[model samples]
Target: MTIQKIIRLLGRFFRPISLKWRLVWRLVVLQVILLTLMIFILLGGLTIAGVIPDNYEGRAIDVIRNTITKDGSGNLMLKQGPLLAELRKEVPNLWFIAKDEHGHELSEGTVPPEFKHITEALDYIGDARFVAEPGGSRTTATVQWAEDTAAGKVQIFTGAQGEFHIMALVSVTPELFLEIILPVGGVMAVATLLVIPLVVRSAFRGLRQAAVLAERIDIDERGVRLPVERIPSEIAPLVRAVNGALDRLDKGYERHKRFLIDAAHELRTPVAILNTRITSLPPTPERARLLQDTARLSTLTDQLLDIQRLGRQAQQFTRFDLVAVARGVVVDLAPMAFAAGYEMSFEPARGELFANGDRTAVERAITNLVQNAIEHGGNAGRITIAVNSPATIEVSDEGDGVPAAEREKIFEPFYRLRPRGHGAGLGLNLVHEIMQIHGGRIELAGSDRKGACFRLVFAQA
Candidate 1:
């Protein structure tokens, strides 16, 4: 497999394990491997430096030979001297048996019953020799030894019956285990337990700081960045990539805001010139119609600019009376409603209704809703502005109500229910943008009497 694929597979397998535990386990495995190498090195060094004797088998044979000899009657016998006692002290479970030339037992200690038949058949006499058999596979009986070789058997004995014979069986002692393996293993275990946790926690400290910094970043806080210094090298590239993406987004947003402002500025001069020329014409029906069309165009242009401004403007919030704003918008639009043969009225709340928001933006939004009601509330000729709570205002008209399917689309920018020339279709979209900037929302609700009710909900102060 490819290196990357193998790395990903390993990550998936180990992902469930906590970082701390993963580090601990790896350290422990390393310690075990190092300890094994140290043991091998120590043994090799001791042998090379002659600190540990390598001729243990030859020395043991010599000790056994010296401990056994023939009496005056030609029978084998064990010497009861300090030399034989010293050998027994050095090798735990040490025992010996001897036989004479006549095939008769002639020693103080007897062999285990299972080995009696085999010992009786031994018939050679020469230099001392040793034989080893794995415990379960022994030709005669079972014997236990040192912890590392609990089921092993060792025999150092003479063979054949024509002369003297001596047989010795022994198990290795615990002193070898204490001297060679324990000290090194104890040191390694202690180090792994004490040092790994602090090391793992220190390594992850940078990642935690990066997480806290990332959590606080948003569109408004685009300039903020996670610090790469002191971060682990393994994760530095990912953090850099995220910061790069944020930079691109901030640049694109600024460019869009600039284009909207420039376009609005460029259109104002031509629209004003058009209005002036229409007024200079002689008084006639055509001239009057041109004047009306120019006024509509001017209104549309203003709405377009409002849409652009509200799209980028951050809300400047203050505590203000929402009911007062709704009443003011109704008063301002009262002349237009009367000219369109409609009656307009504002139902003021019993008490002042206050909300936290930009007062000018809220006033513009209420104006748009009232204008939409005047245009679409077909000849039923009645519009009502109501303040239901500190954070809510509803404008309803007496006209053919909006269709269920078309209600949502009417709020989209430049989307109108009717064809061109009836309205510019930016009114509701501007209102929606204003509500969003103030951290509020707008919704179209069904009116029980007729027509549609558009509700503006703001955050309460």
Candidate 2:
């Protein structure tokens, strides 16, 4: 595959792993690079310290081969100059005995008497190394043949006293890395990898605690702060900034809530007075419409007040009979349903069906559903509030049900299926929030029969 595809695949594979693994991965990669660089560094250091031999052998061989030139009459000769002098410095105690296929021999340095008979035996081969202890002294040397343009195949028998040679380092590199460095590095890597999790967990404790606190900070639970003590300075700023932002958000939310509560309170007096005036008018189609508008306005004002009050309500969830709550709501709205030319009824279960929640909040949620149905359920059909088994209260109307497309959006604040619908649209949203607070949910229970069905599934006691 392409490099881009490989990178994408790697990204996808690693994305799901936590921060600990990512950090570990980066450290491991860095370790590999460090070890690779260490290989060459170790080689160079050992060769410099005379631990490995013949590191500069290639340069020595080239110098000796290139410097072997003819002196006018075309005789094999080892020319002496700065090049040979530099070779002596690199391979200290250097000596060579060169011979050709034509029986010509040119010797340099103190020709060890031990190698005199060995040179004839090495004539059959092009390259070889000999390590012998002659008269209690370890003698090491290399016998190699080089092809020269002027001189036919020159056999070079070379040796050095010191071990500083590039050839020896090159020869020992594979064994050094594979046998010594590889095993040692592998053990080090394994031990580091095994210990990394503990280090990471300890280091990230503050972050984990912060994440947990952040998760629990819902709309109601304001003023919650993440732990910043013992956090690394690099990440402390981000944590403090988040805390500051949350403080500002909480203050802004409180201000908005105060404005809504004050506006609702202020609107009640004027709305009541308007209703009184509209009711006193002579019975007519216009008066009826005005009264309806004023009633909707009053409901909206009450809903706004409910929002503020519920925000401050300390939740004390208890098991209560859902049947009674449903029946009470149906009885309360029976008069309104009757006045609106619709039949209202309650279907309570045979036994007390218990659900865990704030009783007052549950009642309000049920009331909102019934009220919603009455206002928008075509005003000419029956509205049923049924308390079923398994801690549920379902409110369904025998009118045109909510459209399939608008079902999800209806629970959102200020969303109305009809633009001119007689609702401030806070009713369903308020109920939804109530369910969320109770650790339950409100679901749109679609029915094969006509009309919309809204079900409130409460938490088990």
Candidate 3:
């Protein structure tokens, strides 16, 4: 592979995928890298500790001894075979002299003249390696004692050196790999792999806790912050910065919520007084239009206050009777319904069907639905308010049922299917939020009355 491709492959192995797997793969790569250094250290340590002799030529001498046997003449001689042929190739100026204690002697290659007749003196030498002697062209020499079946108690002398041939040792000896490299390195790596996951899980437990805290942060959930305790020093800075940003955002949100509350509270008084003046005016078409506008203003202020209070009020929910809640909305808005030439009716449930919610928020939700029905109910058919079984308060109007295309956006804030210009469009969105806080929902239930239906379903207490 190209260098870039190989680097990318290595990077992919260590990239931030899963924390557990990333740590495992990186440590495994490290173990592999340390194996090479360990091999060098082990070989060097053994040599320093004198476990391996300075003049160790057992590898070369064993080759020579294995090649000795008798010819058909029953005299000791070195057999010419592939191993002997290979040894000749390794040591180009090869030579050996072998003789048993019984005095049968043999020699091979260009032996130094001084050592040519020295095989008879081999009775006392056990094993020895020597550098080139004086006036000698040979670089090294070694002597080994071996006992063979055909040639008994033979002492061999040869011209081979103690230099290590790594490839040759690996090719001839299996124990170097089978015993040392694999056993030591493999055991260390396996034990490391077994223990790493548990260590990683413990180290990252704090991060998981911070993630849990982050998930709980929402617009309605004020003052939530991710903790940095027990997090790694490298990652703790990021958590602290996130908590700071959340604090700034929470401050801005609180300011915005307070402004809306103050503005809506300020407008309520003027809107109520304007509605009173319009109701007191002479009966003119213009007076009717003025009253309608005044009522729309009052409805807008109520919805604004409802939105700000939703979070606080939802926490204070209690078991309240749905019959009482739904009947109250119809009674409160009966006069406005009559002024618009409409019949307002409340079909209470059989008994006091209880629901779990903030009663004021529930009352405001019913009020928004009633206002929505009056605005779009086409100024005909009765505006029906009913408390149904399983804790449902349904407000369905008698206008041209919301068009199939517009039904989806009807509940969206500031969305108007027809530009009748009576609402700021916060009514339905406020209702939807209030229902969400109560773990309830508003659904569209269409009917044959050629008008739209809105069903507010609450959890039965």
In lDDT terms, which candidate is top?
2
Clashing residue pairs for model 3: none
lDDT tens per residue, model 1, 345-376: 78877568888777888899999899898888
Q: Across residues 239-288, which tens digit of lDDT does each residue of candidate 3 receive?
A: 99998999899889989999999999999999998888788989999999
Better of 1 and 3 by TM-score: 3
C-alpha root-mean-square deviation, candidate 3? 7.2
> How many collisions per candidate?
4, 8, 0
Cα lDDT listed for each candidate: 0.68, 0.81, 0.78
Which runs of model 3 end up more than 4 angstroms from their true locations? 1-16, 54-56, 66-97, 100-102, 106-180, 183-193, 269-283, 313-315, 334-350, 446-450
Clash count, candidate 3? 0
Candidate 2 lDDT over 221-244, as tens digits, reads 898998899677789999999999
Local lDDT at 357 for model 3 = 81
Which is the better candidate, 2 or 3, if ranked by TM-score?
A: 3
Candidate 3: deviation at residue 231, Å?
2.3
Candidate 2 local Cα displacement, residue 273, angstroms: 2.2
